[model samples]
Target: MAVRQRVVAGDEVTHVVLDREWKVIAPIEDYLEYLRQEQYSPHTVRSYAGGLASWWTLLEQRGQDWRHVGVDDLARFARRLRDRGSDPTVLALRPSKPAATSTVGSAVTAVLGFYRYHAIVGGVPAARQFYVHVTGGTMQSRSQYASFLGHIGGGQDRRVIGRRRGPSTPAPLLSPQQIAVIKDDAARFEDGNWLGDLRFRLLWSLLEETGVRIAEALLMRHRDWQPGTGTTAFIEVEPREDLRRRLRVKNQHFRRIYVGDELDDLYGEYLFLLAEHGFQFDDDDPIFINFYRGQIGRPLRAETVYDWIEGFKRRHPLLPAEWTPHWFRHFHATALLLAGIPPHVVQRRLGHQDINTLMRTYAHVTDDAEMRAAADWKMLIQRWGAAA
Candidate 1:
């Protein structure tokens, strides 16, 4: 875990909230501190920390030793994990079992992360060393391993270690009502203690309406959104040329979408406030500005979004549990597809690289549609047989 996030872009990034989301460079303690400094929503931090803690305890139990680990040791560790009745091959949830292979894979990757950090501070080993050797890690798993190591330096050297395979699975979705409740707080925030939070309403709203990622939402710039000529207004988002680049879109493809009246009106009102107070809408200006201290022209950063969401959760102590931005993504896609939107169209809207991703994530939701298609084919076959 790291404390200070790397500066959005800098030579030396002190552990800050931004660093928490951008870089995974800090030690667990610093990462934890950075999480606090960045005001990471308690629940988000808790979820990440809970996973990290499981990793940390496993490390301590294994004797925080990082200097020497080979593939054999890693394989042995995986075997040991399986022997202990941990989830053998599961990716996320396995409350019923000790843990699954996917989680075991995660634990292994976490250990590998520790060593990679050590290598950064201590220098690389003389020979190619294996921090985590997976019996089942194909090229696909290797890519996922790369994702986990994305935050650490020289992590690229670590071969991404998963099997080349199909899409894994979607995380569970928060109920629509639950999302509505969170949105309710956001709606009330038009006049809440946290004035900066008014953005949450728009932010959460956008995530639900479209399957945009948190980083994508935070990167929204004045120039990215285009109000079309007709009654149909669309916002054009292209992938940010650089991930570190602020106010940039996620994917590179030009995705033009119809911005519903609700969002358009809210965006209009926000910009009006900026104009009334003498704010400049420069070409490089970010759309979501931070008004916490009533400072004009201060754009909202990514960490600020997370912090705000967590804080919004604070207003409702009576609520059962807190939520994160990703949940909105799940809710958005699942709700739309279940409502009968075609998977391909949903994939395009969600900006997934493939239609299979949409189907795999919402397998339970899409199952019925597939069933209906199957029935139609079956009836057509029967009719053809009768004609013959």
Candidate 2:
């Protein structure tokens, strides 16, 4: 059996094909369809399919069936993934190598879901064999029985499932001086790369000033920016269902964040440059346009921006390897918090649903601010003592 990857609307969907017949297994196909109907993100579906395919291949190698899998089998499956790490070649030969805790956890979750679907849609003996228990509850003398096993939270057993590692180490936050270096480099046109320069500068500016995610910045349209005719300029971030390439905002929260004059000026210059290049400034036009190939004027893809940032970092070795588009978002929040902006105000600007999330995440930055205040207090106290 081979897993074939197909791209639909810029997202990859995986299909499992069996020998000679080149047909996907009915159950796996049904599971994929089920995911689609449930509206799981295409990326998520692809991940689940890949994990299932790995599990299926493992079962075939061991001369065992999916139905025969028990707690021990799950432990072995997790161990196999750990051995595989992230090396695709090694993963193909043998799922051996210690992968990150998160990676292994996702694969196990996929297997769990696959078993769950089969258990729900019965008649398969193998699926029946996987469950060890079932129970019923009575309401008004009418009883409803359900499987107490199979991937349910209160199921047969969950001990074999791998424990995910603790929260990831926070990304390295770029200081103000470091951000200025990137902005300066991005603002300068190199070898007639006008479009690339303008796009990066605009993106960097927005990330620095507004703290919007890269997808949100790339998905913005001319109309999304409201120069509020009165008080302040702001950008609207709301989910759009009509893009050629679907882009989802992280939190799916509708928000309007104010942009300062510096960003306003940068955007103004970018718009002028776009008009100079014969691109129409329609209200629906993508705020960021492709600069290369025939895709000019189309919404820029995340990968493209990533590649540009990577190349920029290569040129300037001072940029940290761990740095990414989201780093600038951290930079934005950290800067605001250090400058004494209210946590709730920063939460609104960052589009975080809860103020607590913002404060919790940036507490270290706030700690530094407190340290500074303490240092100032010490200096003032010493001065007063000397005067006395």
* Model number with the top TM-score: 2
Candidate 2's TM-score: 0.74
Candidate 1: misplaced stretches above 4 Å? 1-71, 79-103, 106-170, 188-197, 241-254, 294-296, 318-320, 368-388
The per-prediction CA RMSD against the true structure, in angstroms, equals 10.0, 7.1
Point to the candidate with the largest lDDT: 2
lDDT per residue as tens, model 2, 307-339: 877887788996687688888899888878878
Measured by C-alpha RMSD in angstroms, how accurate is candidate 1?
A: 10.0
Q: What C-alpha lDDT does candidate 1 achieve relative to the native structure?
A: 0.59
TM-score of each: 0.57, 0.74
lDDT of 1 by residue, 113-202 (tens): 545544554464411454332333322232233233443633344443442233456556677677677767765534533344446777
Clashes of each: 30, 6
lDDT against the true structure, per candidate, is 0.59, 0.71
lDDT of 2 at 157: 34
